[model samples]
Target: MTPTIALLLIITFLLSTVGLLVLIWSISTNQFSNSQNAARTIFTPGEEGHSEDPAREDTSAYKGDSKAAKEAFTARRVQDQSSKPAVLIWLSSAVFWLLIGSFYGLLASIKMHYPEFMADSQWWTFGRIRPMHLNAVVYGWSSMAGIGAVLFLVPRLFKTPLRGTPYAVTGAIIWNIGVILGLGAINFGLSDGQEWLEFPWQVDFLFVLGGALCAVPLLLTCARRTVEHLYVSSWYFLAALVWFPFLFFIANVPKVFPGATGATVNWWFAHNVLGLWVTPLGIGIAYYIIPKILGRPIISYKLSLIGFWSLALFYSQVGIHHLIGGPIPTWLVTLSIVHSVMMSIPVITVAINHHGTMWGSFGRIKESPTLRFVWIGALMYTATSLQGSLMALRSVNVITHFTHYTIAHAHLGMYAFLSFILFGAIYFIMPRLTDREWPWRRMISLHFWLVAIGILIYFVSLTTAGWLQGLALLDAKTPFLEIVQMTIPYLQARSLGGGLMVAGHIVFVVHFIFMLSRRGAMTQGPTLFRVRTKEISQ
Candidate 1:
């Protein structure tokens, strides 16, 4: 047997030995004993089986007059209101970038099928525009929005007033300036030629600085927390804050890894960008929003612990799976595969906690727009994560590698999962920050359907076309031109889907501006798809 295969065997044996040791320790220490008692630790006095939302009947009526509870609620509201300027700055910038990114993305999608559409313009060429779309959405839209939500959430969770609002606002401005310069550089042919790391290294520094400034308040607020119990959401947020800057700095440094090693490092950073950075933000938002709206705790905090640690452990190594069949060591690839399979542990644990929380509360989806968007996003998280694990398998990777199928899967996580969760967060948080309801309820519904249907179409068409393309590439008799020809129709369909998504984004931006300007009928309750008789009459 080859040395690589022998190494793989050795590693597998070591992992099995570790597992055996852990099992033995569990038994010897009676860790599994009193399972019910351990499970009860997730709850506080009188809060079991209860909704966390103060507005919920179970909570509001009984606890409304309790002096300490009322005081805490008032303090929390003050923190939420104080963080508004910073959150608005970040989120508005995010939405603006969303529109710009959508334009770049739709243009790139169209150019795939119609090469002549913008052939004369070097700046609008597929080479530049595609990366621009990627950086714009990933950094400008998703990262900013996640930061905004974190700013809003950390203080509320800690029961402390936000300490560094001015710094956070400055950070938002600095971050936006960095994104602007980076995109301009990309358009002017100053790209680093790396996929996700296209922006020049100087530009990368600004992001690091801006992100550090943004992170200070969160860490300080967390440190000065009044509450004793740190929610699982806070853990995810804190871990992400720690993970992203390290990944960003290591990946962008010059001349560290050369050639094949550089390629491996690039993929490692790219994959972890989603897994550690964006995924945690999305999951953290879901952890808060789902239960906050439903007014209940997550089904199992024990499961949440398993999910978080398992994700951190397994996801870190799984990035190597993207480099399968490359010049990398075979043992590394095998290890990634093992970790990828183990990822199912966290994915399932999260799925159970999130979906289990929603079990009997499905009907509330219709009444509340925030829950509807977040629920669908949370469900997609499970779907995309499982699909990702399967794709990491060598068998599946052989078929889907270097194909548009990968694009479909990325969107299933990025747009369908993370973006949807952020969208829900924007909807929920905006009203509270502005102390105003959404101006147009119909616009919110329109925005949801357009993007939902658009992503469905985008994912389905590209996935089918990619599978066929992959199969054709494997056949010795298949001509290269035939493979290219097969993807054209799907590319056209992708453009159409992209168009719909862009329209949805436009509606969202307009609605957001209206809310910011206080332009609609003022109402007393949360905005719902269908207004109740009591609300309508009032």
Candidate 2:
């Protein structure tokens, strides 16, 4: 809005334009001419982490390769891939954060309905609690879990063992420290005072350092991979690894951009952390786990290629859409909206690949908890992406921008979509990691259904209430008090939903701890949802 801010925005836009031009140039050079080669990594030389029969030795597709190479590959794959102590350590940390964050979320939701419940203590104030809860969930549970999942996946995909387990453990320790320091800073009101960027700038360097340390071995693993073709999941994994730190440092750098343009940077960082960082991580993990469980290659694997590139191309520019009616230029906002709608191209292509992969094999969904959870996430991904594109429209934005509609939309993507994917990833990976099965079928079922029902209630109620709230705001004659009164019922409903979710999280934590301790009656086989025999047989 000011001269300085406008100038900063122009510079930012120009830099982005130059970056896009270079990307187009890379595309023109035929760098992406080999989808076949990339997809072939799924059938890497001697991976035996397959077969429904636990007792069966690998009858890998690459039998023609030399015995020595097979021996070396198998040695690498089994030696430390599933055996590493660090994997469990990181997972345990992730689970701790997931539980704590959900607890924080429950507290925040309570404050929303009953603001005076803890008004006496600034430490427990809503203002401080809300941001802390967000940071905990987004960075703590989601990002850590995502990293843990990919750590398990990369070795399996690359046909290699993880190196530097101690380094990763160190990184996790420092990362947790950074998060704690940041949370403390925020609660003390010594924050950057923006939504996702509230983590104090003083502590930002620790996270960057910690992330870099963790990334070192993962990047080395990418270089050390023996497979001829990098799988599509690897592509997603590599991009997210690179995208997140870069986004974090650039977006959080103090004194880099001034005033209102800083707000642009703030939002751009926050939303892209979702789109470019975690979204790719979830998609990459899904791309691997889905077909692996089905014992088949992804249907129309070429479509996966389209979706990957389109997402990379389209998503980075989309965060600006949140600034549609804000202090920025009209043209930039217009450009962002166009990109948001264009995002549907990637979303639809991904949906086609995902849904089509499971099209006739729908019954497989009934047989594997991994399949059901991941498949539900895939469906939610489609819904959330299309909803996002629609919400980017000016007519839609005018109604939903500042309302609970945005909150509902965010939960749809983050909780319903991403968390579901992460949940399923853990289920699939833990068996391989622990060499055991989920101990209780009922807990698994309860976890799935309770969270599913709670999120549905939370999303639908808030969405409906938000639309009405936004409409009321637009109606100049309507009193603001009436709008506040109207939201009370929906807020109460949200608290109920949040409580159900808390119960589910507790159930899942208990089950996860049982799995870790190797306690209780272990499942003798792959746990799956009950379905008709004919459908499963087909």
Candidate 3:
């Protein structure tokens, strides 16, 4: 085996050993029990039975007029009237970008089927349109939607009204405009030609401006929070808020660094944006949804802290793994590979914390749309990180670099993990926002299955096809054209998967619109899978 491949195997073994040890520890500590009590906690209303301590009692001292504690609790439960306008602005921007991104995906899929579909238009060329598709999906749809959710969720999680609501609205507008102009400029043959940072230097200023605007609401919400205990979700959101703008500004500075160092910095920023920005949002949603649905405190607050800090430390340095075998220095690649392998420390900690928390609640997975989506997303987080670490190994990179395998990895992380978690978040948030339950439970069930199966088809086909192509390229006898031809069948399979996923997205959009219009059925409890009448009787 090549040194890179051998190193990857060693890392895999180490992660597996660590996971086994964790499982053993959990069992010994009685943390491995089923979490059935937790799942019923959400529906248990009032502070009587659910109070953390039984000794606390209602007294005249606590009920005194104009008391600070009472005022704080009231403030926590009340929604801010001013925040609605800002949330709507953010939501509208997110939805518009979602549609544009879907269309770009559709166009890109068509080009795969017919390479010369838009031969006459320079702006429609494959290279230009490909990056546009990526930017549209990542920056336009995902980032916008994530921010909208954050605008809504951060305040709710913190139990406080958003501060500077108007600035938040302004930021959403600016962000939307920036994305549009950046995409337009790139499609119109103006670009820096960097992989993920394709937009020109001038356009980046708008992003910085918009990012500054967003920081205002987040900072204010944090300051105004009534909840004494900061939940794991809040931690992730706060970290992401601090991380994104700093990385964005540093990465977009033009010609500030020398040749290969620039490339190294760019990739570092690119990969971390995924880890710091998108990954945190997804993980935060999971942390909230799993516990909220199960109605339990997180399995172990200490474990979560370990996972969070480990991820922050390890992920920041692993981006150099992407540059392995490139013109970059050898030590940089080795350091990255080491960091990538060490990432398992965080990945396993998070997996244990999330999965272990659900130990006895597996039955609910069948009934709760939010739980099902979030669970799958949580699992995929582990899978994708493992795959990423393996790919970082020099030997694996030699085979997988520039192939569809990398494409498969990206989709697994972005679509399967992050998007799935977001879908769950939407399901959870919509009811709270609209004061009505979902109109169609069956549609949600269908949405879950379609996307799940679509991801399976997408990942399997492309990964197998990519591996074969890579091996063929390595073999001197196989011609390059034959390798290209082999990928067509896999690409066709990918389009099929994309079709299913898009169909599910359409279902979700319609469902969201129905809920927004208040056309859905009214219900007292959450729109859960199982009807648990009197299960948690007050």
Candidate 4:
């Protein structure tokens, strides 16, 4: 490695190490002593009076409030006035993007096996459509849905009205504009040539502005919060809110760092988009939804503290592992791998807290659509993160990196883990926001099974094909072209899986549209799968 690259890698490693040490120090102290209270904050109601500073919620402002106040709040069950309008606007847009992204994903999958399928149009070229599928799904579908969830959950957690609703609404609108503009630019051959950061430089500013706009309302709502203790979910959401804009702008700024440095930033930014931003929101949603629905507190607040801090300290550094064996210094890649392994600590801790809370709720999983999907996602998060840690090892990376094995792992995290959480969030939040029931229980089940089966097929095929391809490539006698040919069948399987997933998304959108229309009435408590007689009798 060159001296300059080595110097940069050393500096980055030292910075990450210092951050980890600081987090460990804070955890060692009693900074998070009130873990139980943190969990209780959401269930606890606010005083009738609001506070100008959110810090007061933990202090004298509501010191005199009684159990009677909580009873009153529960009886009243204040409507989610802060979140409704903005949520509807943002979530509706998210569903729209999900459809677009899934469709593009299917197209991209088809082009993999059938390069001749749409060869004539530059817009439909696999190169362009592939990134469109990625950006549209990540930035357009997942991020927007996450923002909507945060908008909903933050105010509800704080027992405060959503502040700056107009601004949030405007931000959501502008954010959609950015997604549209960015994707449109890419389709028209204006990509920035970065993986997951393909949107042109000019388009990045719109997202930055849109994100800043969405963030202000969340922060202001926090400032106006009435909860005495910050919930673990709140910490994740707020930290993500702060971290994303910082990464978004830094990674998108042009000419600031050129050539190899820029490539490093590109990979860093791309991976952190998953690790830092969207992953936290998904976990935070789980943190809120699991406990609220099951009426059980998380197993240990200290564990939650550990999980959050470890994730914050470790995840940012782990992103660079994507650059393993690349031009970057070996030290940087080594740091990333070490951090990736350290990540398993947080993953295991979170698994314990989430699953331990649901130990006896197996029946509820079948009964509640939200619980089933979210619970499955929580499990998948454990699976995916652990797999990621394993993949970071040099041995595993040799076979997986740049192969379909990597693709399978990516989907396992994004579609299976993150999308499942968002799916559950939409199902849970929609009825609350629209105050209308989903039209059909069977449809929800159908939607679940289709996507579930589809992804299983997709993941299994790609992983097997990727491992074979990697092994083949490693052999000098094996022809690269023959290895590519061998993957054709798996590519076909992938396309088939993509088709099924697309069909599932279609069912979801149709259902969501019905919910929005006059046809969807608040007719049932929740459109769950049919309960067994034994379960019902109990």
lDDT of 2 at 261: 90
Give per-model CA RMSD: 4.2, 5.0, 8.1, 6.6
lDDT by residue for model 1 (1-538), tens: 4876888689879988997898799789875565444333333333334333321111122222346544554565677877888899999999999999999999999999999997997988999999999999999999999999999988877878888888899899999999999999999999988888999999999999999999988988888887656677888999999999999999999988899888888988999999999999999999888876665677787788779889998998888888889998887788888898999999999999899989998997776678888889999999999999999998999989989999999999999999999999998788767756677778889999999999999999999998898888889699999999999999999998999999999999999999889885554342211212222211
A best-first ranking of the candidates according to their TM-score comes to 1, 4, 2, 3
Residue 75's lDDT within candidate 1 is: 65
Candidate 1 worst ten-residue window by lDDT: 54-63
- Estimate, for each residue in 120-201, the C-alpha lDDT of model 2 and write its tens digit: 9989898888888899888888888898888887776777777677778888888889888998998898878888989988
Predicted structure 3: lDDT: 0.75
> Please, what are the lDDT tens digits per residue for candidate 4 over residues 184-299?
99999999888888899899889988999998888898898777778999989989988998998899887787887887898788888888999999999999888766656787
Of candidates 4 and 3, the better by TM-score: 4
- Candidate 2 colliding pairs: 367-528
Give the per-residue lDDT digits (tens) of candidate 3, residues 1-538.
3787788779879977987898799779865344433323222233212211101111111111235534543443345233566766776566566667766775676688678888688888887888888898888878877877777777757777888887888888788888999999889999888888988879888888887898898898789776655677778889999999889889988989778999899889989989889998888778867766665666776777778878987898888877778898786788889989999998998899889887887987777787788888999999999899899887888888878898899999998898888777677666555546778888888888888898888899889888888888888898898899989988888888877877777777787788778897664432222222323321
Q: Better model by TM-score, 2 or 4? A: 4
Deviation of model 3 at 284, angstroms: 1.3
Every candidate's lDDT: 0.84, 0.79, 0.75, 0.83
- Number of backbone collisions per candidate: 3, 1, 4, 1
Q: Model 1 segments beyond 4 Å from truth?
A: 1-63, 523-538
Each candidate's TM vs. the true structure?
Answer: 0.90, 0.88, 0.84, 0.89
Best by lDDT: 1
